[model samples]
Target: MKVVVRVKLLPSPEQAEALQATLHACNRAANAASGVAFTTGATHKFALQQHVYAALKVKFGLSAQPAVRVIGKVADAYTTRTAHLDKGLLGHKGSKRRARSEATPIRFRPDSAQPFDDRCLSWQLDARTVSIWTTRGRMKNLAFTGSPDQLKALAEHHQGESDLIVQDGMWFVSATCEVPEKPLNTEPTGFTGVDLGIVEIATTSTGQRHAGRILNRYRRRQNRLRAKLQKKNTKSTKRVLKRLRRRESRRARDVNHMISKSIVERAERTGHGIALEDLKGIRGRARQAKRNRYTLHSWSFAQLRDFLTYKARRAGVPVVVVDPAYSSQSCSECDHTSRRNRPSQAVFACTGCGVVMHADTNASRNLARRGEIVWNAGRSVSRPCPSL
Candidate 1:
């Protein structure tokens, strides 16, 4: 599997200036390439590269490799846009938003991330430094730092291009690493079903609950602060808003990592597969009041799912996704299903069988049962014929 390991770059002021200039030049070249691609309708990589390669080197002071990278980035952006259009992410056919998106040329931010291949960037894992090409010239021995695990991964498996990104005035290099996965466990003892919800971030069929109340409180406070800052509408307020946004994101990411690690480790240790809800398009399908919409949208269910998937894959743990419909309202014990079973957010009472349980736990148990049924059905089909 390909994983990205990000390391912080601690550069001198002059080096920072050079890096900034290089990024600006690259993005400027990208914007120009996008314009040509849009006007001429030559959006593929080679077609766009032919038109912009020579011009980028002459006009933007980019080298051959950087110029090519800029063109490739523009082409990739167009490719992504085309895919989104095909998937109707922007809007349906004849929608004003779709037409407006299709009409305009794509633009790049001045400090957007730029990729550097081996020719442009070299890493010294032992020295914790990197030699990279810059607009000023080649920069050598630029110091970097990362966590022990991240450094180890980079040293052992780092491959392909690394992206130079500036976020909140900090420089970072995100290096791609190709890590090997363990052999998958085809025969699992059982399955652990995890129910994801707003109140409780995760609840497992094994009677484990990861509450989200603290995180929710923090997010609510952050939201209030953001509103206040927006009301002020001052330069300093904008800076504060950016910092707060980054901090909140980091906090949420850390929490999700911890939660996922614990869940994956337990499943691996117990020789069990993971069961999850297939909750795609949840935001579009679900509706809430104006005030509660922020809370609903702010839930990081997708991120948690992604983390679980990759971690489980690495641990050779099988993961099954089942339909989430009525998972909460259905009775885990009696197989009864009704909307009234969930009389409240936390309680689940089956009117048919009078079996009561925690709402999230009941949902998780239902997911586990569904996952086992699916897994068994597949096993039976895939089972080998009897010896003749």
Candidate 2:
């Protein structure tokens, strides 16, 4: 399993500037290569690598090995993205679309100045030291490391993963270690239905809900600052705007981590799988919603789903994505479907069954039903009784 461990770089000012310069050069190389690929209709991985290699040597004055590494990274991204698109996993884009691939240009953990092993691309960390390697050299137990307990705690929290990649001014690191070959076994005894919403980040089928009021506050503050920055049009404004963007991202990630963790824990304890909407076509559908478009646009449904998926996978729980056709409108009790079932955001009143329940809960129950069906189809087991 690939994991990234991130530690603050206590580098001198000169070293920091040098790292930034390297990142800028790398970005420039990637962008140039992407543009070349788009214009030449050379979407193949090898063609993109050739262009990047040429650009790096002639334009950036990089050496042979470094150039190869950079190009190789870009090619890998291109190949991965192409596969995703081919598999209908990635969204469709115009033919003129360019690949803005980001890669780990520099390594900055287990003490700075140590280079990365291009082939291995990951490091192993224990209580006392970290091991890193490169094509030319390897380093072991680089001195002046952090507290062993702290490191261990971080490792345990992340599940034993260690790798760091710098991309787009942010460090993308694998946060978990040992990905189990098979996720923890979960019996489809019950289903935890999750409703992703803008205001309340998630409303579970189990009547548990998580609100994103704090996240919204941070977003509002960021938006206001961004607006002011645009109006000011000054260098300082730009700097502030950049910081705000980072701050907002951190806040969103924190909230997502907490919410995803809670949902996974709940599912694991209950021996159930999670049910969520397959929000693949949501963007196009939202575009047609017009005045009510904000509801869908503001919802971080995709992020929430992704979070739940990986978290559940790591915890050995199952997550089921159901057809969201009429989950909101269908009555959970009698299977009555109609537009009148969901009279409002919070209320669900069934016309045929005379059943009334919280709108979120009702949707969750419907999701649970779908999850049960999916589970039974996959496993030849007797249907489990509904809990909610």
The numbered model that scores best in TM-score is 1
Segments of candidate 2 deviating more than 4 angstroms: 24-67, 78-115, 118-150, 153-176, 181-183, 287-295, 380-388
Tens digits of lDDT, candidate 1, 1-388: 9999999999999999999999998999899999999999999999888787888999999998888888888999999999999999999999999999999999999999999999999999889899999999999999999999999999899889999999988999999999999899999999999999889999999988999999999999988899999999999999888777677777888899999999999999999999999999999999898989999998989999999999999999999999988899889998889999989999999999999889999999999999998888877856678999
Candidate 1 ranges beyond 4 A from true positions:
232-236, 382-388
Clashing pairs in 2: 3-163, 4-163, 4-174, 5-163, 117-134, 159-177, 160-177, 161-177, 184-316, 193-205
Clashes of each: 0, 10
In order of appearance, the predictions have TM-scores of 0.95, 0.71
Every candidate's lDDT: 0.93, 0.64
lDDT value for candidate 2?
0.64
